[model samples]
Target: DARVTQTPRHKVTEMGQEVTMRCQPILGHNTVFWYRQTMMQGLELLAYFRNRAPLDDSGMPKDRFSAEMPDATLATLKIQPSEPRDSAVYFCASASTTQGGFSPLHFGNGTRLTVT
Candidate 1:
């Protein structure tokens, strides 16, 4: 089955700590997405990349969070000086695109992060 793989399924950190999450997207997919889920925000798209290139990341805090694709299969998200408000589940998803649109995305189980 085609699936996204993520590392460090859970993390607990004190405020001001740094947190890093990694993902491996399904092979042959050209689109990668990062999302954050919280009680207040529900599900918000943090970043979007096409063909391993970042398309948008305005939903995330620029000074604290960053997302990147080192290659086609790997995607990484990092948060520096993490805050209590950053406690949430982060998800990585992969999808194929057609005619500039997108196909159905396959999502990873998610990484649960807690910042105290």
Candidate 2:
């Protein structure tokens, strides 16, 4: 399978732990979307590609989590000192948004993170 999502699909970490998740889109799919699913907020777009360059994750808590695309195929999300409230399933989707709106080709199976 493509690196749309990372494995182990379920992750468990204690509070104040550091968690890192990585994803790689299929070839030619330049855009990536990072979303978090929660009971209260449902699907939340934490970050995504912008202007065909590196993502600007200003919408998220910069100090808590950081997102970036080092190359065309690889993307990474890191959470430092993760809190229990950060528990949720994170999905990474790849699409060709450069040409049009979101048209995802592959989506990550989603990583269920449980912080306690």
Candidate 3:
């Protein structure tokens, strides 16, 4: 299927537990991104990628969250010792860079994480 896919659509975990979310972008898209959505902040960027190499992850908290693209299709977001405040809908998006510029983003439904 030509669609972005996310695993464990709903996750509930205890405080301080480690949580991992996985994504598979639409095949052949070269760029991927991770973003988190909260009621107050809306959508916040939390990842980085350009041709399979991390470009900028400054939007995410360096201490707890990590975003990585191990290969072209797979991207992962992880929270080590997750906290209650970390709850949110995490989305994965992919796009192709055009010579003309500005390709549309295809996003997965998101992994909803709730830490108690």
Put down candidate 2 lDDT per residue, 11-112, tens digits, no spaces. Answer: 899999999888877677878888899989998888888434656566578789988888877788889989998999998888876455666557888889
Instruction: Score candidate 2 by lDDT.
Output: 0.80
Off by over 4 Å in 1: none
Better of 1 and 2 by TM-score: 1
Off by more than 4 A, model 2: 1-3, 50-52, 98-100
Error of 2 at 41 (Å): 0.8
Candidate 2, residue 114: how far the Cα is off, in Å: 0.6
- Tell me the TM-score of each prediction against the true structure: 0.97, 0.85, 0.95
lDDT of 3 by residue, 1-116 (tens): 58899998999999999999999988989889899999999999887687889888999888998888888878999999899999999999999989975489889999999999
What is the lDDT for 31 in model 1?
97
Best by lDDT: 1
Highest-scoring model, TM-score? 1
Note the clash tally of each candidate. Answer: 0, 0, 0
Error of 3 at 57 (Å): 0.3
Residue 84, candidate 3: C-alpha displacement in angstroms: 0.5
Better of 1 and 3 by lDDT: 1
Query: Clashing residue pairs, candidate 2?
Result: none
